[model samples]
Target: MQYAIPAPPPWWSRLLARMSPTEDMPTRGRHPRALVTPHHDEPRPTLAELYRARRLDMVRLALFLVDDLHTAEDVVQDAFAAVCRHHGTSLDGLQDPAAYLHTAVVNAARSVLRRRRTARGHTPPHAGYGPPVDEGLLLAEEHRQVLDALAQLTRRQREVLVLRYWSELTEAQIAKTLGLSRGTVKSTASRALDALEKKLKVVR
Candidate 1:
């Protein structure tokens, strides 16, 4: 007698759909505004405007890296501070402030992780707060499960996956952010997705 294999759950498909880059990503018109370079004629946003727009997104990105909302906020704060120190509040003479800030946030998150590793007496923050809550994005049960699976991945894998899917960064941008080659970023993301899918399978 022949038997059919069990299909993956609906949520698995949803998860992949959410994680995959949009088809329009290859088109210049559909690129993320933050990633796109502004034309000379276009008005540049002030530092405050950029902060208001990107702060929450940056915090979300950091939360995935550090695994704590409070610490993530701190990391983002430090990133802004570093940018201001180097570029000033006016953001004068910087051609790509958003890109610069993206690199700063990634570096800041790395620093936090490094410090946590070195501090012998470091106590992880309490888990009472639970998975991160965002006004615009609510975490469902399956998505929370995915986050749990993500936590099991290596640091490099986690960074590659998060930056690729969550931040919607391209391979080149992820490579520049993590100081890895584009090929490395591509391979790591592929491996990371395979690992993540396997982990999710066990849960499903």
Candidate 2:
């Protein structure tokens, strides 16, 4: 007897599309490889330039991780402030400022969640988040459903899924950012995807 594989969800493509930043957002923010310009000897972007290019993108990322629009914006702002405090406005001596900023955003979001957990006593950090008001970050109903599913995942699972799919980070990069082994990132992503799909099926 042959067993048939289950069909993937019809909205899977749309879900991925919704997860990505807009097409016009700078590619350098997500892919560190694009920062290399040794052949042409281009100067690295200043911290201000990097912030202008990547701030919104990072906010979108933090939004997914924290599931609150205002809190997400604050998280990205704090990340930038932390980077500036450490590396200066010129971002001198930083091998990869973009990657550094990304890590900072993730860490800041984690801190926000941790504090909420301690104060709220078992409530998820995203609980009672208001609808997003930013026009640039607005989502369709289907996309909101996807985000709701993501909110149900554990923090590590959410981070792995967002970094893997939304930011399009390689497993090695994710491992370094999250301080996890590559094997753990791989397994977490697999399990997260499975859980998310089940949640989406229920939503449908």
Please name the candidate that would achieve the greatest lDDT relative to the true structure.
2
lDDT at 45, model 2: 70
Highest TM-score: give the candidate number: 2
Residue lDDT tens for model 1, 1-204: 222212334654586455333242232233336433467877666677668767767777787787776788999999999988987887767787777777898889889978876673455555233444561253456667877788789989999888877677777888888899887887787777778889989998
> Which lDDT tens digits does candidate 2 get at residues 114-165?
9877867765767744665773356677878877899899999999877776
Q: Model 2, stretches more than 4 Å misplaced?
A: 1-12, 16-41, 122-127, 132-137
lDDT of 2: 0.77
**How displaced is residue 23 in candidate 1, in Å?**
27
> Residue 193 in candidate 1 has what lDDT?
78
Clashing pairs in 1: none
Q: List the residue pairs that clash in candidate 2.
A: none
